[model samples]
Target: MGTRLLFLVTAALANGVALAQTDVPAQLRVEETRASQLMPILHHLTDIYGPRLTGSPQLRQAQEWAAQQMRSWGLKNVELQPWEFGRPGWHNRLTEISVTAPFQAPVLARALPWTPSTNGLIVADAVILMPPGMPAAGRAPRRTADSIQAAKGGVAEPPMPKMNASPPLPTRAELLAYLESQKEKVRGAIVLVGPPAAPEPDFIPQPMRRTDAEWMALINAPPGIAPGSSTRPTVEDGRLTRDEINATIAEFLVKNGALARVKDGGERRGLIRVESTNGYGATPQVPGVTIANSDYGRIARVLQGGTRVEVRMNVQNELHPDGSTAYNVVADLPGTDKSDEIVMIGAHIDGWATASGAADDAVGAAVMMEAMRLLKTSGLKPRRTIRIALWGGEEQGVYGSQAYVARHFGSFEHPKPGFAKLSGYINLDHGTGRPRAATYFGPQSGAAIVAQKMASFRDWGFMGANTASFRPVSDSAAFYLAGLPSIGLYQDPFDYLSRLHHTNFDTYEEVYEPDVRIAAVEVAALAFALANDDKMLPRFDANDIPSRDPAAGPRARIRPPENHGEP
Candidate 1:
């Protein structure tokens, strides 16, 4: 009878301990995260600092500010870790593009980064420059029988004009020769490349979240469903690539004394999608701009009506000297017994210079900062140290994170002293949407561990865990390729892809406060849990670490220093 009573008592004590362990996350959810505490951090990153393009002065200033804030919060070992950028840093000072002829109107446009300034305002006539064999736009064509049958059968139609078949694009040599032939016409004109398509109307409402059915389908689907690496095609692509073609056209413009090159921005509803110049050097000789599709279409229509259109443009840009480098912001929250082991949370601090880059990465950097603050203020003593890295050069080629990993913790082919001591990394770079669940890239058992650890925050929309479809192409991919355990959060789409990404609309107003607050709290809880766990997150064997493309991975192409100026 005494033995039975003692057994019951022991079981109750064990159960009590388990309950306390689970309650820590619950306690954090209820007490630590507050909107007032979080929004100010985000405001400083976006509103005050604006876009932090890698190697730009704005990014350098922001990195210093972030490091100072981490130290003031009682975090230790804060530093601005530097890495070679290998090219001149460029930023836009002023860009003014307007349509003055046929009728006075303002055209929505922005200069491509790393492109040259026009030196001053220049007014010039416009000429249409289409690629060889690309058919000119005309009246709508009648639908073919195949199209009608495909529509009736609910099959997707082919992605081309209905009945207006066009010849194949010219070979590379042929394209160059054709451009040489048009030298006289392009010598002194602002070239408009290609006709613009009318924007299609979107009828469906914005999705709040993917349904369970949709997620399951995505999980079960074969690999390559989602996008892979976005590395541009090179000489090895076996044929003429669009990038090569564009580069050739730009070279032609430079040689032929063209005033500038303008194209449709390829976005809907007057939104302009911005991108950098393809050149690896400081800037190109001829300037380039992508205006709103609506504006481009209007100009094309006027030109088709034989009414000559003229444009006036004035652009200014600055480029840092050769051998300039960018930096990553690093800090640490020391632990109790397991201070040597590290758990990392990171987000990129750099973004495209289109807007303030609020959704692209400002929200992400804010989340990491707030997570550190939450853990510190809650007086939690984790077992492993929690580190935060605000990475730079992620927009260029994820250079900051890769450089840190290679320097501190070497890759699978080469291991450093700290390689084995690191536990795992959690990265948030998706957008301002709430983090719905955690996805890991490792053994199958790690999913169960993550699901168990995240049970406490189920109501905050973090309920489940799943294996990643493929390795991430963001900052996390660096760690993943290095054979370290890495985790990523799956969030709602929330205009990140359709409207905001790399566009002028990525301002502070696009951020939803409540959602990002939840994201910060979830990151804090997960980091703390991983820190105190008995064992680290499961990792794949060295042999199982998948190899990635050389072009798509960390190492970026370095241009010669001599090419850092106008020819």
Candidate 2:
């Protein structure tokens, strides 16, 4: 508040903005804005905090730690706003699985987050069930030739509805409609059985786009399951209309008589890591768990042959039912000139409890913390307020961000005021691959122009990286839905697709220090620039996509930003 202190603070903030732009003094560069000072904070977050599983104790600790750290660094209004929603909270505390049966192998996997848990002892031989391919009685065994031929676009038989089953599963349309409703019939106990495969093995299926109808057409028409061992079956999740397939699967389940068909493992088979923030569009399994993929495949093979395999898994995950409420962490560092106007950066602090959720976002939470620290400590006073959110329940269809946006901006019940004043929301939830680039995701014409402006201070060439855009998947989507300008920061990944993304392997060692430092700096600098920029980012073209009319229920929204694919 003194003249000297004010001058010093002004000078330091000016320097932060300048150093990011032009070549600066060695002393300041080496001392004030270097990456090394940021490491300890990152270490504390990723290492000490470990994995901040959503709604778990760790997530709460990290949230409090972040708020305290930010406030200590001189941020005001650093309060954790409790988010109230239908399903504000869900978690899996302890999951112990022992394969007790013929040829028993200790299961090496965790159930997905928000999945029900088991407490009873139930055992059965592991079943390897394949996808709904042709009835093995009429089909050949799986082979490389079969895989290869199935990869091509030639079906042998017309599709036929799955028969000889219990009852019909939820229809595709039914599933889509259900997805909108944020509700589920969480029963007594549910065991997470996924595809049984080598742990986190790296593999990619041939890229093939097939919708539910297309897949059914492939199945019933000619030779649906790979003919002999010549062709391969492929599914490109990105390009396919998964909702349709999910509905079909649901319908099949309902039509078929089964309690729940769980998979055994991850990746190779249909089993995916429950902790992973990523998800297949529609809920793959409702009444059942996505059991071990390997187990399912094995069971399918036996069934295909002349062997009948009956396996049962006793599952028990009891919830308090009375005690379940999730919360989101919302803290702020007000600006001097434009304190009410906002510049928000968010990352889901909560995680799946596989292996301390190190990569999925432990790195992200740390980076956001570091970015806030940089802004707070550096004595930077921009024109807009800087807000950070450590969202809870994001893994369960982005409930945290959705709740906050609805509460502050607008929601299903009523639209809130102050929409026009919100400058932008910046979110960083991708793992610790380093902030490679910022996606420019708004409208095409306007997005191009805004992207150029951000390129000015993002010394990492992030503007060209294409992460600053309107991808309706992460927390950013929540803000975008309100018609405010926003962006999501992205970093490079180490085994993101195969190992880390959301499995136990997402530990501390996997995060690249240099990459995180670079990311932290990029995000901080961009926050500064966006806060200081004279204009707001552009909006998506009205004609680009149809708006959500609330005709169906609210479901998880995800989008692969334009022009990003495997290298």
Candidate 3:
């Protein structure tokens, strides 16, 4: 009887231990199964609030809405943190572009952000001037009547003009000279200053769908290096930067009586790709539009074939002056014992107006918001405060996040008390896909800690974690540079780069509901684990981190494509 009783007790104890081990995953599973909650929140942001361009009224409205939502969920200290984004605010009211001469057709286009109004309906002759040195199709090797007859008689004709032979791009001086010579003809015309729109290829490179091994490798790699990592930028020789060239061209166009400037939207199909100006706090001198590549190509070919073209442009855009204040939405779930220590999760709230900015960042913002909601509703109290920051002006230059970092934790170049109190930061900005892994951008020592924490949710698609010491390309960059542990979630690429990101196609329809649900659950679980951890994540020595070259200021780096906005 005694032996039988002992066996029963041992069996009960084993069962109890198994149940305890499964508790976290069980909660996470419940969260994932109920992940559908994200869809409505995403809809409210993308469908109802729409595009949240930085410094625009719409963005402010969205920020207010987000804060109110957080407050409703019982989050503490929910507020809009204001920052001075030096750039002027812009909003598009109306835009209409149509070809009038050669053939009448409506040309689909969107005014680039911050582009000035056309004043009134500006109907002008369209002049296609190839930026100096772009090859003009050489006159097909002159076909003589004898050569034509020979070819007709099955004999090979004289070799055609070398179609590929073209001169090197002209120097800045040469470009200016060419424009000057054409002053009489170009005055008051709508100049097509865009490069020749290349024909769409049969296949475009796609983002690698992350495999299990690839995801695991990312988590386990050391800092400052990862698969497909590129070398840091260095100061260049005397050649003028692309921004300089563009600025010069813009100024010249405005000075020379140009009505407006039109460029081919470098997007697949006829989709529009919009971008903002490069000015720190100014608007473009003249109106600019990015038209569909197909339409732009048609106009260019007509012009090249010696046919006259005329276009009518009507744009109404408003620019709020400098000193405009943009905001970052902030709220926190207060911690118990370690309230002073912080674990931050953020996503940029600002995006271009081309679409509703759904995939580019709305999904990111929604994921963070949903994750916070889950933690609150799950009745789990954390040790360190969990803060959610939805940053504005990220599309501009990571301005909002940088300002927040500077104000709260001091600049990356100068550390403050709050900087050390930061346990770590995790950012989500890749897209609407589920989080498969984590990327660390600080000390390599922290990778082990992250890996151990992430191991708990391995079944929830926690592949692994990795480290790098490069400057961040996202909001976490500020924290990373400040010597705090920072991480970004690596997500599956569900056509984010191929079709939806920064284009008109980035709408609510493109969002994968199931994936977003999984993302919210994963993000919430990670935040919970990080905040509840007993020890703060380790930081690396500044010397160990790869510092930006002093001479190579922000301008020297290879920036994302204009339409990419901010990562």
Of candidate 3, the 10-residue stretch with the lowest lDDT total is 554-563
User: What residue pairs are clashing in model 3?
Assistant: 219-465, 219-466, 220-465, 223-467, 223-468, 224-468, 224-469
In order, the Cα lDDT scores of the candidates are 0.75, 0.52, 0.73
* Candidate 1 per-residue C-alpha lDDT over 28-92 given as tens digits, one digit per residue, 9 for 90 to 100: 55444322367788788888887777778888888888999888889999999889988877778
Model number with the top lDDT = 1
Q: Candidate 3: give its CA RMSD in angstroms.
A: 8.4
TM for every model, in the order presented, reads: 0.85, 0.64, 0.85
Q: What's model 3's TM-score?
A: 0.85
Tens-place lDDT per residue, model 2, 1-567, is 245644554576556643333221121223334435555665666677655655555566777777777777776777777764343234444444444333344444455444443324443333332332212211122346656466443766557675455223334454445433411321222222222344432223322222334323322332111221111234343322323453444444434333443544435533345533122212333333444456545554554565534343544433333224567767777876777778788887776655667667767777777777776655567778888887876665677887788778783224577555566677777666655344444544444543554454344434343323223556666775555566665444465644565566677777777667766666676677667766665554445432455332222123223212111
Q: After superposition, how far is residue 135 of candidate 3 from its true place, in Å?
A: 10
TM-score, candidate number 1: 0.85
